[model samples]
Target: MDFSTPIMIIGLVAVMLALRVPVGFTLLISGTLGFAMSRGLDSTLQTLGARFYDIGSGYSLSAVPLFLLMGHMAIASGVTDDMFKAARTFVGHIKGSLVLATTFAAVGFAACSGSTTSTTAIFGKVALPEMMRVGVDRRLAAGCIATVGTLAGMIPPSVVLLVYGIIAQESIPRLFIAGIVPGLLTALAFGIMIYVRVMRKPELAPALPPSTRAEKIDAVKSVWAAILLAFIVIGGIYLGVFTPTEAGAMGAAGAFLIALFRGRVTIDAMKNVFIETSKTTSVIFIIMVGALIFTSYLAVSGTSGAVSAWIVGLEVNPGVLVILYLVFMLILGLFIDPISVMFLTVPIFLPPLVRLGLDPIWIGILVTKSLEIGLITPPIGLNAFVLKSVSPGFSFKEIYGGIWWFLQVELIVLAILFSFPELTTWLPDLMYGG
Candidate 1:
């Protein structure tokens, strides 16, 4: 339970993770070992067993698989392509419109899919080429897809937010609502950046011819499924007819029917859907368990409380404290996954922030918004790498270069959200009459 003990455990976990020990097992084994060393094997085993049950039996964890299922069904149903087609029809011909359209489409898709990489990969394949063909700036085009992809967390049914809500014991519905304004603001911010980039250098995003009246109507009609789906899921939740978990279930059910009606659902496809869902779900569960173990280790070593004590001891303004905290996460994100960052740090950080009078739900949005900055950050940019793998022609350097503007825009949005909690909190409050 000494300070040195937590430091040692942290070091061990980092080494194991860096060695590519499966993240789930690395954190689990490392934390278990740390606990055993500090508390004796019998007590450590008891702690581990208790922690496992506590984490597994959590009501909020139930949201993970159901939401994952929702996203998987949405993807398997071929709804993403339809969503993108509708987005392109409306915005494709505008100046840098396809890139902006991809941004627009991603926000809408993320509301349904709730996977950053899903939106990223979907747009990477569907919109990237079209932008390139129209002479869009490669940097801007790739960066737009890479950054916009992160909307999955900012939108409802967000896997990351679900995990955060579960761990923090916050309202998933409130978290969903808290994310809406910031999410839309983020999308709009990206759109504006694209608009400015295109106008400053017109060649970067040349305008497409306007769509015909019939074409515009068809675009609107094609997206009716996604529209109805979003309304049912988000609107229902906002109206309090559904909890986050129930809404996720309903979303999955709706996605399945839509897929079936479209004739895309076959027995084989269903099997694959379940198989894929299990694989993804297993990864999430294991990490959840591992993070549980890690969190326990931090508690046993008293590191969680110590970090907070140290932070609160700082003699700086609270606003500066907020900026410093985000900077710390941004740096850690350079080498860690967002979930890992969330699990490892939240116990220590959030407690102190709340003790300082910050709103937990608003801070939740701020945490995710900060982590989004890390998505395109180097050395550990997961979204950027997702694009790199699919892009045979684009350079990682170029992608990284373009990401600066996206990162800049997101940082500005983060600042706005930090200063004005209403941007992230008003909708949820209004919906609940808080």
Candidate 2:
């Protein structure tokens, strides 16, 4: 294959998507054509088998559906609602605290969710209204909830990070561990930003009256559903009693229990939840398959190795090349969905990274972190769009504007992570006893 085949394939993908074609289909069609153009029709067909087997037979991929089912069940069962309600009560008393609470709460919520868009949509509906009613700034409230939605991908149990781990051949446990401090740090950064805004201009946030001790306790009791579910799912993963897949099953079961006992999820709703879960899981797997096809094509064409060599020939330092890759991901993220970007780039990009002897775990964290920031970055922040659907009286523009500072904060956080590999490595080392 010519050097330009990969670039042409990528450009065509953007054109197809720009014309509003479906994303998965765009990937499949582009990848297939790329293969056929390079290897002819017969070999493209042969590549299909290996693509399906690679993604289908993945034990780690099994965790995707299972965790997704858990999220669906969590929504259906009202566990999500309970958790946010608790967040409201706890944070409502402070000025602009509700907005801060959304960021704080999302870290908890992301522990169970798989999709960044879904997390934004769910919390936008659940958290935004309460904040608005409490006289929180509409844009601020909505953006925090939406942007933190990306936390669904940043924190442990994040399906995106799971996929990156699989593609990069990094440890799942390490990826999970690497995200913890950074996730919380991002949330804190958001919280501090919110607090400052409310402090400087009191009208943007009006504090709820102080809650009595009894009120606080009662509110705590109200959201135990979220806490319990998180404990069972996240806590279980860290305990090693079950793998991420088993934890997902356990979370699904747990979500069902929360709904059944609380009389929140009905028989009618339960069916829809299952159906949605299946649809989502299928879409993800298909994307995974498309990505594999493209990767296989790249491998066959020798484009991946050639690209790595070309990159090495750029004559800048290896670390500089890594930063360039990060910038490329950031730019791509502004225009495309993170998952598709991951599939399309990781396979082609990983070889160069490993060749440079960069730590795979560190690279995985960097990829996930950059993508997580992209979820809220402008031009086409998916989380912002998700929030648009549910934010009471806000426009996408306002949400985008509100997130600019937070975006800067995220960039700084990313810089720190990139500069100090130990930020991501220490927990994994301590946990693994290395």
Candidate 3:
């Protein structure tokens, strides 16, 4: 095989992926073959070993597992329930208030969990029943749960941003800072979409009896632990009190303390958090190492350079190049998971980004925004499937239909980010001196 050809390497990867091979292995096999074809078997073996050592020992990557541990501990502590309860108490009486509350809960859970699938599943189990009891339309309830769950991806302490930082060689904390405005804007957009939707079509939601002042006070108190936890974790990061890694440690410890205070902590739960963190971290690291190996081959083979030249030679507008890349990402998301998409595309897409002198921080936000849309898109929409798995009673059509307006909201957000690059870069610059 003439591994000198980038297309040949890409084709092999696609075939292996089509056969359902694990992404890590697919990259490893393909990269190793290409490396050997270009630079002999001995050189390929040496490169693979060196790359693994470099990736495994990198200090920045240590943050990955700690953040994962924090998220899992928060979930195990039952903060999701408290957050949802608080949101419900305050917002459950307005038109489509239950849906509004779900969106709020999704944001809170996104803070703790940072996993869209988990947020959707937890809320689908918790919020959907209440929405049903209040006669909220099934399509609207399920769709909101599926779509709004993606708030976590844009929010600070996002695992996706962490991974992107590691790959893009950008600052992790700056990435975290950049996510703040965009995440809140996305959540607000979802809220507005719901309010307008239910208001125009009053049949979709029923107003509940408004809560009394005392009830509202009690609801606020119930969520004090969550508020405090977010402050310690997210606040600490924003205030420069600690690095993201330190914040992760504090967040995990705080989650455990909150769980203990609530009498929800147990040895088994702690054990499960560690076990799950380790599993998730291992998978992420494997994919990353494989991506590094493959990227090394691409660099040595000059394929990346050639692609960069070809893209630049076209003399297209940089904005158009970005839009085309985003469209490609959205289409790819229809078949693959977000992590795989990140690993496969970042290396290929990054060269063009640099050649065009685009800001990586802004590009990072755009990439994440696309991934957010991918989570709700049809076919392989991970969040939608999670909602369906949690509640099989809702038809897929109802669930997909429910997200149409929210999808429009997401598209608007994307356009805004594209038009105003400062929206993504402002906070990071303010905090980090750009």
The prediction achieving the highest lDDT against the true structure is: 3
Q: Is candidate 2 or candidate 3 better by lDDT?
A: 3
Each prediction's RMSD to truth: 1.7, 2.0, 1.8
Query: Candidate 2: where are CA atoms >4 Å away?
Result: 4-7
How would you encode candidate 1's per-residue C-alpha lDDT over 42-110 as one tens digit per residue? 988888788779767867677677778888888888777777777878887766678888888888889
Query: If ranked by TM-score, best first, what sequence of candidates would result?
Result: 3, 1, 2
Q: Tell me the TM-score of model 1.
A: 0.95
Score each candidate by Cα lDDT.
Answer: 0.82, 0.79, 0.84
* Tens-digit lDDT track of model 2 for 1-434: 45788789979988998997867788888889999998899888888887788777888888888888878877887656766756767887776767766776787778767678888888878877787677777667766776888778878778888788878777776777778877887788878878888899988878877667787788688667767777776666665667777877887788778778888777789889989999988888888887788677777778788888887667778788789889988887876778878988998887777877888888888888898787788878777777777764788788988878778888998998899888888877876334
Sequence-dependent TM-score of model 2 = 0.94
Q: Show the lowest summed lDDT stretch of 10 residues, model 2.
A: 232-241
| TM-scores, each model vs. reference | 0.95, 0.94, 0.96
